[model samples]
Target: MVALRGVTRTVRLPDDQELHILRGVDLTVNSGDHTAVVGRSGCGKSTLLNLLGLLDVPTGGELTFLGTPVQHLRDSARARLRGEAVGFVFQQFNLLPGRSALDNVMTPLLYAGGKQFWRRREIAMDILDRVGLAHRARTMPTMLSGGEQQRVAIARALVRRPRLILADEPTGALDVDTGQTVMALLDTVATESGAALITITHDVNVAALARACYRLETGVLSAAAIPTGANA
Candidate 1:
């Protein structure tokens, strides 16, 4: 559902020097595909994710989402498209401080229209239940454990029923066992929802769960083999 060809991102420094981030990166994500991108710090993974999520535009090359070229879209159009077709899960579990789990999940539907806005609570609750957070729907983020909070974050991302799900280091903040559980839950949900899952991680074990694995280095992305028995 998404394709990037010769994508490049560069930033201008105060000294008028240009710093290149992404260098002609090409990627393709198909419907219901599970893909993983592994990279180190300052390796341009964040820039790539921003471009893929439509939060930012590439300085060069073309990006297409769902068959529509997004390189020339206005900010408002990009925002609308992102809200309608993309779901994001962050490593920090970006939930509102005072909002309940259900309310947090309902935040995305606020941008969505029609029946979704009116029935947001029900939809959010259902997703929370799917993520095993039904009983914690009314709880605040502070009251929930790390795993529960991540589950709520997942629920929020899926509430919109996005066609593409972008998860950035989703298990980074949890313990090993908790992270495993969360990854399992994420994979199951994405498969069940038929959303293309793109996970940006630094862990090979995490990358192993994906059908396609890639490594990002020096602003370039290339396919990598999932090691034998590496699946968690």
Candidate 2:
């Protein structure tokens, strides 16, 4: 579970211009909850995710994960906590060009469990297998279709059994059909793992699959009630 209280992040441009990304945003995601955040482009969805993932500290207010006040943690402690608890998916996929699918999934585990390279590889392969990519485990990203590559990315995110999976526009790069497949894969993984999954999307159809949906407008987040089994 994750909670943000009056969280705000601002940046000052070189010319004394101030950009406020997140303005006192307060939200909570419960365990096993699939939540969708929909907003127009440049509305701070990804910035909120980065704050949730502990990749960046908030400029003001507080963020808590499982009741822990993470904003004040040391850099090393934050990194360790992030690796142990958070998984990430991005619009770009962010897969390594030289690594095979199996290798890419295993990358996270290397930082975990004492960094024994081969141990992570075995665990990664198992995750890849669970994602139905065992046969394509040896294939490179360039050789795989968009959906396949995204599945591999999902496998990589799940390799560590993270408690929270932050997906930022995960289906943005694929066509409609392919995007559906990718969303299905994400839903299946979160359900199987019982992890709190938060997906940031602009598409209403994609947002409907989530158990809860919220819309961001004018620096505020409001929950939206979507019909059951309508777009999932």
Candidate 3:
């Protein structure tokens, strides 16, 4: 569902030096696959996620989705592609403070399909139920707990039924038990929807849930073989 070839992103520092965030990164993800990107801060993990989501363009190399070269698309075209093909979950829930959980989750559907607008509420409710947040549907983000808010975010990400899911530090704000619950919910949603999932996390336990895992360090991405005792 996603591929990157020799992708490199560079930024100029005030010191007149170039900082290479991603260096010759080559990666691919297929339908029904789950990938975990493990790295410390400033290791280009989020940069890689942004590239996959088409939120940012790489300075060099090719990124393709469903066989289309994403780098060649126009800005409006890229936005349309993102709305149709991608969903994103972040460490911060990013819900509107005044909106109820149901309303927040339905926001994605508004940009998804014009004909599906009226049905967005129902779809949002279903996703909330799937994420075990049906009881909090009418609650506002401030009134909900951290885990609850993240669950609402997950519901929003799933409401569109996009082909791919990009999650960056999704469980970072929650406690251990809550993080585990949220991760499991994410895993279940991706499996049920048949959408390829890519998660960037610093936690080793969280990374173990994916079918394939990789670590980013020093401008390189390396794959790891799964062991029999990986965390579920």
Best by lDDT: 1
Query: Which has the higher TM-score value, candidate number 1 or candidate number 3?
Result: 1
Per-model clash counts, in order, read 0, 0, 0
Compose the digit string of candidate 1's lDDT tens values, residues 1-232: 9999999999999999999999999999998999999999989989999999999999999999999999878999999999999999999999999999989999999888899989988998999999998998889999999999999999999999999999999999998778878888998999998999999999776787889998999999999997443453
Model 3 residue 135 lDDT?
90
TM-score of each: 0.97, 0.93, 0.94
Estimate the Cα RMSD of every predicted model relative to the unseen true structure. Answer: 1.2, 2.0, 1.7
What is the lDDT of every predicted structure here? 0.91, 0.86, 0.88
lDDT of candidate 2 at residue 225, scale 0 to 100: 80
Runs with alpha carbons beyond 4 Å of true place in candidate 3: 226-232
Q: Report how far off residue 20 is in candidate 2 (Å).
A: 2.2
Candidate 3 least-lDDT 10 residues: 223-232
Ranking by lDDT: 1, 3, 2
For model 1, the superposed segments whose C-alpha errors exceed 4 Å read 228-232
Residue-level lDDT of model 2, residues 1-232, one tens digit each, is: 7898999999999999988888898899887999998889888887887898999888988999878888789989899999999999888899999999988998887787564455887788788888889999889999999889889989988888999998989988888788888888889988889999999988776787888988887567888885343354
- Model 2 segments more than 4 A misplaced: 114-118, 227-232
Q: List the residue pairs that clash in candidate 1.
A: none
